[model samples]
Target chain A: MSMVEKKLSTKTQVILTLLFILGMALLLWWADKGFDSYKQRVLRLIGIYAIMAVSLNLINGITGIFSLGHAGFILIGAYTAAILTLTPSEKAMSYLFGIQPWIKNLHADFFTATLAGGFMAALAAFLIGWPVLRLTGDYLAIASLGFAEIVRIWANNALTITNGPLGLKAIPEYSNIWWVYGWLLFTVVFIASLVYSSYGRALKAIRESRIAAESMGINVFKHQLMSFVVGAFFAGISGSLYAHWLTTVDPRITTMGPMLTFYVLIMIVLGGLGSITGSLIGAAIFAILFEWLRDLEQPFNFFGITVPGIPGIRILVISALFIAVMIFWQRGIMGREELTWNNLYKWLFARRKEGEKS
Target chain B: MNQEVFFLQNFFNALMLGGLYALIAVGYTMVYGILRLINFAHGDIMMMGVYFAFYTAVLFSSPPLIAAIVAVAGAAGLGFLIDRIAYKPLRNAPRISALITAIGMSFFLESFAVVVFGAVQKPFVQIFKTKESKVILNKVLMVGGARIPLLTFLVILLTLAIFAVLFLIVYKSKIGMAMRAISMDIPTTALMGINVDGVIGFTFALGSALAAASGIMWAMRYPNVYPYMGFMPGMKAFIAAVVGGIGSIPGAVVGGLLLGFIEIFTVSYFPTMSGYRDAFSFIILILILMFKPSGILGKKAIEKV
Candidate 1:
C-alpha cells in the first residue's frame, strides 16, 4: 500500500510541477504583452527582489550565518555590471571627475557584464568571508555590516572609478521582464536543489550546532564560505538587474546600509526562513505592498472614506508591520516549510475527498 | 605657536565629543552585558530623547532642567517598554529572531520619528535663551594660546560624574550585583529567586537614560535636530562599546575616548583626507574583529555543546 501511495504521489507531483510552470509562463507572456510600463517596472522589480530574497536566504536562512553584508556585495555587483555595460561615450559623460582610462574603453554585452558582476561579488564574498566567517552570531553580523560601510565609504571616495557622489547615468536600460525573471527562475531552482542536497544538509547541521557539526566531521568553515560566496553571486546578479532597471547607481549609505539588509532579512523571515518558496512569496508580497503603500503618501479614498495623506507613511507602516510580525507571527506565511509538489498534491486530494464526502 | 594652539583646540573638542560618546556607549554596554542582545534601537532611542527635549523646551516652554529631566525619563520609559513589547516575547526564541526584532524596533522608532517630526532638519538651540542666539555655546575661554568652550569642560566633568555613579551602582549595589550575575548566567540567577525580567527592564531604563543624556549633549554640540541625527553617533558609540569589550563600562569609556582622539586628530592632521574620516571607525571595527574579536577589555567566551 505504501509503495502504491508513493508511485501515485510521484505522478501527481510531476503534474503539479508542469501546471506551475504553465501558469508562470502564461503570466510572463501577459506581463510582456498587456502591462503598461509602470506595471512592467514593478513586475521586473519583484523578480529582482525575489532573486535577492532567495539568494540571501541561502546564506542567512539555510546556512544560518546571519550576515549583514548583502548590500556590500550588491554594490560590487552593481558597479561592476554598470561599468562593464556602459559605452565609452556614456562613461565620459557620467565621470565628471574623470574616468579610469582602461574602464572607459571597456564594454560588454548585458549577459557578459552580469556574469562579471556575479564573479566580482563572489570574489568579494570569498575575501570577506575568509576572516569574517570565523566570527559567529551578532559579531559576524556587525563585522559584515562594517564591511558594507567600508565599501560605501570607498565608493564615496573612489571618484575615478565610481564617479563619487554623482554616480553613473545613461548607461542603458537593459533590464526587462525576461532577463529579470529568467535569472530569478534560475536562482530559485538552483537554490531549491542546493537546499535539498547532501551539501545543503551539512549547512543545516552547521546552522543547528557548529560544534556538533564539526564533531561529526563537517568542515564548518568551508561550507559556510561556499554558501556565502554563492549567495553573493546571486546578490550580484540581482544588483546587476537593479542597476540596469534603474539606470543609475550611487554610493549612499542609505542605499547600501544595514537598512536594505533588514528589508531583505524581513522578506526571508516573512516568507518563512529556510523555505525557498517562502522567499519567493515573501518577495512578491513585499514588493507589491511597498509599491501599493505609495497611496499612503497622498490623500486617498479607501472604501469611500477619505484618509488624509501623511509624509513617510509608507515607511512608517512597513516598519510597524515588520515589528508586529516579529513579535506576534514569527513563522510568517510559512515556517521553514517548503511549498513542494507533494504538499500540493496532498492538499488537492484532501479537498477532493472532503467535496465528495459533502 | 599657532600650530600648537590648533592641536590643543582640536584635542579639547575631541575630548568633549568622546565624553558624550562614552555616555552613550555605556548605555549600549550595560544593556548588552545584561541581555547579550545588541539593542539596535538604542541609537534611535537617543534620537527620540533629543526630540523629546526639543519638543518640551520649544513647545511646552519648559525650563532647561525640566526639559533635560523629561528627555532622560522619557527615554528610560521607552527603553523599558521596548524590552517589554519587542524583546520580551523572544526571550526563549532563537537569538536571530531577537536580533531581527531589534533591527525592526530600530527601524520602527526611526520611521516613527520621521513621520512625527518631519524629515527635514530642525534647529536645536539653547533652551535658556540669552542675548546671543546661543546658550553655553556663546561662552568661550582662553588657556594659553588655545581657546576652549566652557561646554567642553562641563561635558567631560558630567561624563566623569556619571561614570563614577555607574561604577558605584554596578560594583556596590545589590541590583548591580544581580545584573552582573545575570550576565554571567541568567537561568541560575533566576533560579536564585531573583526577578530576571524586572532586572533586565531596569537595566534597559538605566542604559537608555544615559543615552538620552548623551543625545541631549550631542544635539547641543551639533545644534541640529533631525530624525536621523542619532545614527552616526549611535553607530560610533556601539563600535565604542565593542572596542572596549562590549559588556565592560570602563572599556566603553576607553574605546570612546580613543576613537574620538584618533578620529579628530586624524582629521586635524590630514585636512585633505577629512572626507574619509567616517571610514576610520569601520576600519577599526574590522581590524578589532579580525585580530581580537573579544575586544580590548572583553573576555573570550567558551562555546558549549
Candidate 2:
C-alpha cells in the first residue's frame, strides 16, 4: 500500500506484460518453423477460440447477459468474409443456384474482407440487440437461441446471397498463426481494458443488481446492448478467421444442431465464467482436448487386443465432463480471479505474511 | 387429391400434430412448474421412450400395448434417475448453474443415445400393422364428403384421455396438491411435512411418461425412430410450454395446438415457405416474450428487486 511498493508493482507488471508478448512472438516463430500441418492447425484454432471465448465471457460472464445467439453473429461474419474473399470465378462455381448480379463481381483482400465481416456482424448485433436485449435471464437465453436458429434457416433458404446450403468453397486461405494470434492479443487487451473501465464497472453493477444500477443512473439496456454488440463484433472477427483458415463456409456450421455454441459455452464454464485468464486457459484446453478426443472415435489396439472404434464416444465423454464440471466445480477454474503476477506472488509467498498479519 | 380433400387431410394432420405436441408440452410444463429449471433432456427422454418401445416390441415379441407400457415406465425411470443425479445436487446452487447442468444433461443423453443406438434412422415397427389393428386404424369416416383416417381420431382421443387423467390426478389427488404446494415454495412445503423431493420426483416421472407416449405416437404417425428424432419436437413443445405460460398445464396444451395449426397452415397455404416452418414457432416465441412474458395461462411473479 506504500507509494514505493505501488511503483514497484507497476514496474513489475509492465516488465511481465512485455515478457509475455515476447514469449508469444517466439512461440509463433517456432510454430512457423517447427510445427507440422496438424499442430499448426490446432495452434491456430486455439488462438481463434481464445478470441471467441473471451468475447463471449464479456457478454455472458461480465455483463451477466445470457445471450446464446453467438452462432448467428459467427454465421454472418463467415458468410460475409467468404463471399467477399472468394474470387469471382470461385463464386460462380460455388453459387450453383445463381449468384446475385450486384455482388457477383465484388471481391476484396483478406484484411478488408475480414474487417467488413466484423462490421456487418456488429451492425446485425446492434439491430437485433435493440429488441432482444429487453428480455432477461432464461427468457433472454431462449430468445437468443431462437434468433440463431432463425439466422441458420435464413442462410439455408437464401439462395441468391448464401447459395442456400450448397455453401461456399475454395475461399482463399489467408489465416495463419500470426493472424489468429494477433487478433487474439487485440481481443484480450481490448476486452480486459474495457472490463477495467467505468463502463465495465457499470456492467458488473447491472449484473449484481439491476435496480440498484438503475438507481445509480446507469442505463442498463444501453450498457447491455453495447456489451452484446461488442461481443458480437469479436465473434464475427473470429468467424472470419475460422472461415479463411478452413477455406470453406456453410450454414450447418452455424446451426445449433452442430453444437458449436455449446462448445463455446463449455469452454467459458470450464475456464471460469468471468475471468479473462480463465477464458484463455479454457480455450486452450478445449481446442487441445477436442483434437485429442478423436482417438476415442478411432480404432486403437491395446496389448494385442483390437478395440472397435465408437464414433460418438468422444462427444459423450465431453458432455459428461461438462455435467461433472457444472455439478462439482460450479465456480469453474478461475472463480472470478485473474492470473496476475501479484496474485501468483500471494499464492506462492505472501500466505505466511497474511497469516502473521491476521 | 381435390382441393377440399387436401384441405381436410391437412386439417386433420394439424390436429394430430397438435395432440402430439400437447403431450410433450405437458411434460415440460410440469417439470418447469416444479423445478423452475427447463429440463433440456426432456426431449431426449422421449427419444429414449421411442427406442425403448421399439426394442421391447422387437426383442421380446411383446404385444403393442405391453411395449407402450414398458416404454412409458422406462422413460419414467430415466427421468427419475436424471433428476436425482443431475438436478438434485444443484438444488441450492444458482439457477443459472442448474440451467447449464440441464444443457449438459441434454447433450449427455443425446450423444449417449447416438453411441448406444447408432446414428442411423431405424424404421419403427407399426403397432397397427396387424390385420385386426389396421381394421381399427384404417376405419375412415366421411366428413363433408372427405374421408378422414381413423388413426388421426385415435391420436386425438388418446391425447385427450391422457390430459383428462392428468387433470384429475393433479386437481383431485393429494399428491397433486403436494406438487402445487412445492411449486409455490419448496421450503415451506418441506416444513409443512410434505416430502418435497418425492413430489418433484413424481412430477418428473409423470412428465417423462407423457413424453414417452408422445414419442411413440409420433413414431406411429411418422414411423422413423432416430437418436436425434426428439430434438425438434422437444424444442417445439418447450416453446409451447412457454407460449401457454410455462408452468400451466392447460396453457401448454393450448400453445401446442396453436403452434401445430400455425406450422401446418404455413405449409399448406404457402408451399414455398414449408422449409421455414420451424422458424415460425421461434418467431412466435419472441413475440410472446415481448408482449406477454407470463404466457397465456401463467401467473406473473413480481420480481423481488
Candidate 3:
C-alpha cells in the first residue's frame, strides 16, 4: 500500500515483461539467421503446430470435451485460404470445376487469406457446434470425428473449389519462421488472456463439473460452444499456415484418421489439461521428439556401430514411452499448473520465511 | 429396365450385408449396454481376426471351417485381454478416460498390425469355394431374369442360425440373466454376488467372436482384406447399433440390415453419390444422437438429479 512498495512492484513487473520479450526476440533472431534452412523450417513448423496444439487445449482441456474432428476445421481453413490467395493467372489457367468468372480475377495476400480462412472455420464451428455439442462423452467424440470425415468427403467430392481428390497444388509459400512465431506468440498471449478472464473461469468450471456448473446457473452449452469455436478458429489458422507453408493441400492430409486427433489429444493429455504453459511445453517437446525420431532411419554410426532404419525403431520406442507415460506419469509435465514468473521467483529465492511470503 | 431383378439383387445383397453388420454390431451394443463405452478398438479386433484366420489358413493349409475356428479363438483371446488391460482398470474412472484408452488401444493394435503385417494390402481368399449358382424362382415370369445367388440364401440361413444361438444364450442361460442384471444396475448385480469382471470378459469374448465371424464373411463377400478395412465397416456397424437401439440384440440386427440396404441401394441407384456413403452414415449417426439418443429399441436411461 505504500508508495515505495507500489513502485517496486511496478518495476518488477516491467523487468519480468522485458526479460520474456528479450528471450523470445533472441529465439526469433536465432531461427531467422543462425539455424540452417531445414532447422528453420522445423522451428517454423513447431511454431505453427504449437499454436494449433495450445489452441486445441481451449476445447479439449478447458472445456473437457473429447473432439476428434479438429482436422476438419483445419481443412476448412486451409482450403478457404488457398482459394482466397490463389493467383489470378493460376485461376485462369486451371479451373476447379470452373471457378466463378467474377471471383477468378480476385486474389488476397497471405495475411488476409489466413484470417479469412480462420474466420470461415469459426463460422462453421458456430453452426455445427450449436447442435453437436449437446452430446456428452464418447458420442460427441465420434460425432465430431464423423463431422471431420464428412468435411473430408465433401471436400473430396466438391470439385469446383477443392479440385476433388487431386487437391489444391502450387499454393504460395508465404509462411516464414518470423510470421509463424509472431502468430504463435499471438495465440499464446490471446489464450492466456482469455483463460485469466471471467469467461475462462466459467469455461473451466463447466469442464470440471458440467452438471454442477449448470446447477450453479452457468450456461454450459454456450460456454462449450464458445470454447469449441475459439479452439477451432486457431486450428483453422494453423491449417491456413500449413497450406501456405506446404504450398499444397490434399484431402488425404486430413484422412490419416483418428491418428492425427489422437496425437493432438495425447499431446494435451500428456501436458496437463487446463494449463496453457503445459500445452506449449508439450507441443515443443512432442514436435522436436517426433522430428528427431523421424530422422533416425538414416544411419548414424556411433563409434563404428552402424544403426539402420532407426525411424521404425523410434516409433516403437516412442509408443512404448507413451504407454509408460500414460500409465505412470499421467497429468503430464505441468500437472495443470502454469510455469509463471511467480513460481520461478519463488523457487529462485527459496523460503524468505513468513515475513516475505508475498 | 429390369427393375424387379435389380431390386431383388439389391435387396438380397443389402440383407446379407446387414446380417453381417448386425453380427458385428451385437458385440458393440452388448458392451455399451453394460459399460457405456464405445470400444473404439472393436473394429481393429475384427481385422485382427481376419489376419489370424488368414495366417491360420496359410499355416495348416486347412479348410475354411478350421481357419474360422482359429480366428474366433484369436479374437476371443484379444477381447479377453482388452477387457483385462484397458477396460478393467478404468471401470471406476471417468467414461471418457476409458474411451481414450480404447482409442489408444486401437492405435496400439493397428500400429502393431501395420508393423507385423508390413502395412501391405492383403486379399482374403475364401477357403470355402462356393460356386455361384443361378436359382429360378417362378421362372415363367422372370423378374428381370435375375437369379438369386446360392451364397446369399446361405448367408441368410447362417445369420438366422447364429442369431437363434445368440438369443438362446442371452435368454436361456444363467450368464444371460447376469448380463441383463448387470446392464440394469451394476451395483445391485455386484451385491447379488455376481462376478462382474468375468461376466464382462465373457461378454467381450462372445462379442469378439461374433465380430470375427462377421469379418470372415465380409472378407468373403468383398474379397479384399486390408489392415485398415475394418475402420469404415466398424463405424458403419456402430452407427447401426445406435440406430437399432444399442443394447437390444434384435435391434442391432435390424439396424445392421437396414443400414446395409440403405447403403447398397443408395450406391447402386445413385452411383455419383457413392462417395458420400460414409458421410451418409455419419449424418444418420449425428441425427440419431441429436433426436433419439436412446435409439429405436433402446430404453431411455436417466441420471439422478
Candidate 4:
C-alpha cells in the first residue's frame, strides 16, 4: 500500500502493456500489407464471425443457456442498418407512403449505420428478453425461437421498413478488414475485461447456479437480461457487418430457421464451450471449412472421369461430419481451456513430453 | 338461402383443421408429458412419416387401406428406432443436451430426405379424392358463403376414432395404468416392478403412430408434400400442446382445436393480420407462461426443493 511501491508497480504494468500493444501492432501491420484483397476479405469475414461467436458465447457458453434466437438479433440489426443508411432515392422509391422529409436522404456512414443497427437490435432484445428470459431451460429456448420467428414475420410483412420478403439488396460493401477487425478487437477486449472483472465473476456465478447466485445477493433476472442485451448488441453489429460485406440484406436470407444458429452452435461447441479463444478458432475453422467444401458443389473430374451431383454429395458429407463431431468430440478441441500462452506452449510441447515419457 | 351456410362451412373447416392438429398434438403432448422436453425434431419426424406414406402408396398402388397400414407401420418403426438409438441414451443429460441432439437429428433427417427426395415440392394425391358435397342445414348458416367440404366430416369421424382409441388405452387398460403411474412418478413405478423403459418406448410408439396418421391427414388437406412440410404444423402442434395442458391427454385435443380456430378466424376476419398467424400462438404461450404456466386444464406440481 506504500506510495513508492504503487508507483513502481504502475510503471512496470505500463511497460508490459506497451510491449504487448507494440507486439500486436507489429503483427497486424505485417499481416495487413501481405494479405491480398481476398485474404483481407477472409480476415474481415473472420472478424465478423468472431463477433457473432463471441456474443453467442455470452448466452450459450457463459450463461449455460441454449438460445436459437441469435439470428433474430442479426435480422433486426440488418434491417435497421438498411433503413438507416440507404439513400433518399432508395427510401423514396421503396416507401409507398414516401420517406420522412427530414431523414429521407440521411445516409449515415458505416460506423453510424452499424451502431444504429446494434442499438436497435439491443432495444428489440430488451423488449423481448424481459418476458421470455423468465423461462429457463427448454421453455426459454422454444420461446426465444418463437420470438425469432415472430421478428422474421414482422420483417416480412412490414414493407414500410423491410421491403417485404423480396429483401433489401444493393447495400454498400463497407465492412473491410480494418472495420471488421476494429469491432472485433473492441468486442474482444470489452468482453474479456468484463469477464475478468467482478461483474463477470458474478455473471459466472449466476450461470453456475441461478438460485445460489440469487441467494448470494446477485440479481439473477437483471444479470441475465444484461447478458442477453449485450450479447444481442454484438449480434446486431455482426449482422450489420454481414449486410455490408455481402452487399445485400434480406429477411429471406436470414430466414432458414435454426440452421444458421445450429451451425454457429456447432462451431462454438466444437471449439470448446466457455472459451473465447475456442470461439475465435472455431469460427475461423468453420469459415475456412465451409469455403473449402463449397468447391464440392461443382462438377469435378477424378482421373479424367467426371463426377455428378457434387452439391448433394457435399451436404451428406458435411452433415455426417457434424454428427461425428457431436458424438465423438463432445468437449470440442479446446475443452473450455483458453488459448493462452501457457496453454499454447503446452500444446506445442506435447511431442517433447511424449518423447520424454517414451 | 342465407350466409349462415358459409359461417357453418368455415366453422366446419376450422373443426376439421383442429382435428388434424389434435392428431399431431397428442404425440407432442405424450412425449412432453413423459420427458418434459420439447422435441424440436418432432415436426421432421412427421415429415418422414409423410414421405413414408408417399413411398408406400407408390409401392402398393392399389388398396389404399394396405398402403396406409404399411406407411403408418414404417413411420412407427422409424419413430421407435429414433427414440431407442438417439434419445433414450441421453435421457439423463441436461435438457439442453437433449435439445441440441433433437435439433441435430432434425437436421440429419431433413437433409437426408432432401438428398433422397430433392428440394422440390411434390403434390400428395389422396388414395381417393372426393368431390365436394353439400351439407344441408335447417338454418341458413353462412360466413360469406364459404362452402363446407364433406371431407371435413370424415376428419371429424377420424378424430373421434383416435380419441376413443387413446381414451380406452390410457384409462381403461392395464398398460394405460402403468403409463399413468410412470408419468406421475417413474421411480415409484419402477420400484413397483413395472418396466419403465418398455412403457416409455410404448409411449413413443403411440405418439409416433398418431403423428404419422396426422401427417397423412395433413397431406390430404394441404395436398403438397415436401421434405420440410412438417415444420410449420409441428411448431403449431407444439404450441397447441403448450396451450392445452402439456401432459394432459384431453388438453392436446382442446389445444389443437383452439389453435386451428385461431388460425382460421385470424385469416378469415383480418387477412392483413394473417402474417401474425404464428406470432399469435407464441404470444398466447408467453401469456400462458407468465400468467398460468400449467396451461388450461393442466395440474400444477410443486417442486420440493
A best-first ranking of the candidates according to their TM-score comes to 2, 1, 3, 4
* Over 4 Å off, model 4: A1-42, A93-103, A253-256, A301-305, A310-319, A345-358, B1-3, B126-146
- Report candidate 3's fraction of native contacts: 0.42
* TM-score for predicted model 4 compared with the true structure: 0.89
Query: lDDT of all the models against the reference?
Result: 0.88, 0.88, 0.81, 0.77
Worst 10 residues of 1 chain A by lDDT: A1-10
Candidate 3 lDDT, B81-121, residue by residue in tens: 98997678778777777777777777777667766675677
What RMSD does model 4 have? Answer: 5.1
Task: List DockQ for all candidates.
Answer: 0.77, 0.82, 0.44, 0.46
lDDT of 2 by residue, A1-358 (tens): 2223312378888899899899989979998889999999999989988888998899999999988888888888888988998888888888889989988898999888888888998998998897789898888988888888888888889899999877788888889889889889889999999999999999999988888999999999999999999999999999899898878777873242337778888999999998999999999999999889888788988789988888888789999999999999988899788998877875676444334432
What digit string (tens of lDDT, one per residue) describes model 4 on residues B241-295? 8888889989998999998898888887788898777678877777877777777
Interface RMSD of 3: 2.3
Comparing 3 and 4 on lDDT, the stronger one: 3
Candidate 1 per-residue lDDT over residues B250-293, each given as its tens digit: 89998999889989999989997888888898788888888988
Task: List, residue by residue over A131-214, the lDDT tens digit for candidate 1.
Answer: 899989998988898888888888888899999888887768899888998898889888878888999999999998999999
Task: Between candidates 1 and 4, name the one with more favorable TM-score.
Answer: 1
Residue B301's lDDT within candidate 4 is 63
Candidate 2 wrongly placed segments (more than 4 Å): A1-8, A253-258, A352-358, B1-5, B126-129, B133-141
